[model samples]
Target: MPSLRVLNHAFRAWRRNRAWAKHEPETPFLADLLSGAPTCLHVGASDGRHSYVMTQVAPKAVIYAFEPSAFAFEVLKLGIAWHRMGKQVTAIHAAVADKPGELMLVTPKKSSGRMGRAYAYVAETKPNGPARPDLEDTGMETQMTPVVTLDAFCADHAIDRVDFIRMDIEGAEQRALEGAALILDRDHPHVLLEIHPPMLQARFGGSGEAVVDLFLKRGYRMFALDGVRLEERTTLVADLPWKDYFFIHPSRAARLPDGVFKARMAA
Candidate 1:
């Protein structure tokens, strides 16, 4: 039998595709920015749904997907095998962070030993201290997971070029970006990131603007989906309405079709 989580994922994908068919604007699909034989990273890939989408859109695209949670990694591997996509997607079990080290992954308590919860996050750590183990009250459990930096991973795998990256690592986006600075500088891949303001502040002790600045400082322009059109953003407020954003380097902006963005900020 399929896991309940896997069934839920399938339902969500069906609904999303139904919406797109109705011409309801959702987050712009990866097809908008990807093309032939691109090298991509699906960081924080859970269950490999996005990776499957990548294969559907760009058949020749090679993807390296990283998932930290043991349960999620199992599901991801199952999906890969189910889809027979082993040749195109390489699923690895590890967290992507600012440095290559171990971190505690905190996830909500599950109903059974075999079931898995969603939206697990990196446990908060004190300065020069170990991960906090006081999450019991929050109905969460922690496990130590191997961590790797994008720069080191790419170099180790001999991956010289990256065309696109989609990251949704809970509130650890800033840390992942810090880890990928080398690749960001060299490849300028189109990045799709989800900014969790509450998680950023409460868990990571950071802000959305700080994450936005990470891209702006690197000459990457920010754009957000408004459910109707994409809007270029120069800054983000505390109560910013959107969560997902596209941080496109200047070099890749031309490939995106015209009129898709409002261009609120000059490029």
Candidate 2:
């Protein structure tokens, strides 16, 4: 049984997630991408909320769920099993980074402001950018978690093509991308990332600009998608905080409807 504090924290996190779900609901471009995508990747997938949603939104899609938290991974597993979605979703308990090795991760309980966000920062961040003020002490001790690279994992699993990838792995986004060069170069899968400057600073020792560069360097056109209107971005600014950004691999841009990547016109 979980402790009272853990249970209470979970309840609060769920409440915040529900509110965000109501406000942000999934977008159409995502629907289009998932419609026929044979495979999808969901990193930092906590409790399978989005995974379950994806199974419905993209009935033909096979989703990969990666989470580093043991407590959360168990819940995520249970959720997938409860929904009878074993065939469509596969869960892994590893953190993806620029290299394959072990690293210490500092995890804060799901107690973030704005929308109950939890964060796991790499203990030793060779960040590409400067650090910002710590959001909070978090006070949680560091835990050893297995680290894997996207490129290596794909090779080992023999996954030739990937259609879409949604990542929100705290702040190790850059490192994860850094390790996925081969896959991106070959498939150019649509990459959706959640960017948090403070978290990036705290964890990766880098900035959002660095995160964006990881894709742009590999021939991807990136856009900020959290706004009511989607806009292409050369880089991310810490002052201009954004949640989700989409990167299209040039080849699939014409296939998607404009509205999925365009601004919503007032009715």
Candidate 3:
């Protein structure tokens, strides 16, 4: 049995997630794409609220959720068992990067404003930009986490088909994308990423355009949701107005709802 504090935290997290999903424009689209049995990669999975939501929306979806923070990973595992989603959702205790190496995983001791364990991220060097301000007051701790490339992880796990990938690994999106080059080129899975321009520039000396270029060069069209409608994005500026965007390969475009993504209104 779990402790009272753990149970209370779980309840609060569940409630918060429910409220968050209600306003999220991508939630319905996720349901649409994941209605059937699909292989999903949930990078920066935190305490597994999103993975738990995936299980609810797509009962047969096999989710490989990765979280580097030890504290968050424990919470994620507890949630997996609490929800009885252990069979469908596999939690991995590692960070994804461009190469297989080790990085320092920084996590706050408690919730820092709206940010909590979910904001935990791995860095090869000291964090900067938007990540810098948080470190000033938040009691922080670091753990050396083993990093793995998506391409290697999939090849080793024999995941030939990845239907969808939800990545929100702070500023390390580009590196993770680089690591998954093989998967991106071969499977062309639907990628939904949260691109933080300041974080990107601070951590990797890269910008949002660089992240968009990764998909554009691969013949992938990126789209952003305007409330519930999907609008095509031709170019990504250095300052991104939106954080979450969808990167879909031309071949996979047909899988999405024609009415939503087909209109192709420029963003």
Q: State every prediction's TM-score relative to the real structure.
A: 0.81, 0.79, 0.85
lDDT of 2 by residue, 105-140 (tens): 665433342222355556563333222234443235
- Candidate topping lDDT: 3
The per-prediction tally of clashing pairs is 0, 2, 0
Instruction: Give per-residue lDDT, candidate 3, residue 170.
Output: 78
**Alpha-carbon local distance difference test for all models:** 0.75, 0.69, 0.77
The residue ranges of model 3 lying beyond 4 angstroms of the native Cα positions read 1-7, 16-23, 108-115, 127-139, 237-242, 257-259, 262-267
- For 1-267, candidate 1 gives per-residue lDDT tens digits of 667876666455445543444321333457677778989999998867778778878899999999998777877877777677899999989999888889988775543543234557776442222222222223456788899999999999999999989898878888898999999999899888888776677678777889999899989888777555677788763475237888888776665534343233224
lDDT of 1 at 227: 58
Quote model 3's TM-score. Answer: 0.85
How does candidate 1 score on lDDT? 0.75
Candidates' RMSD to native: 4.9, 4.9, 3.4
For TM-score, the strongest prediction is 3
Where does the lowest 10-residue lDDT sum fall in candidate 3?
Answer: 128-137
In order of lDDT, best first, we have 3, 1, 2
Clashing residue pairs, backbone N/CA/C < 3 A, model 1:
none
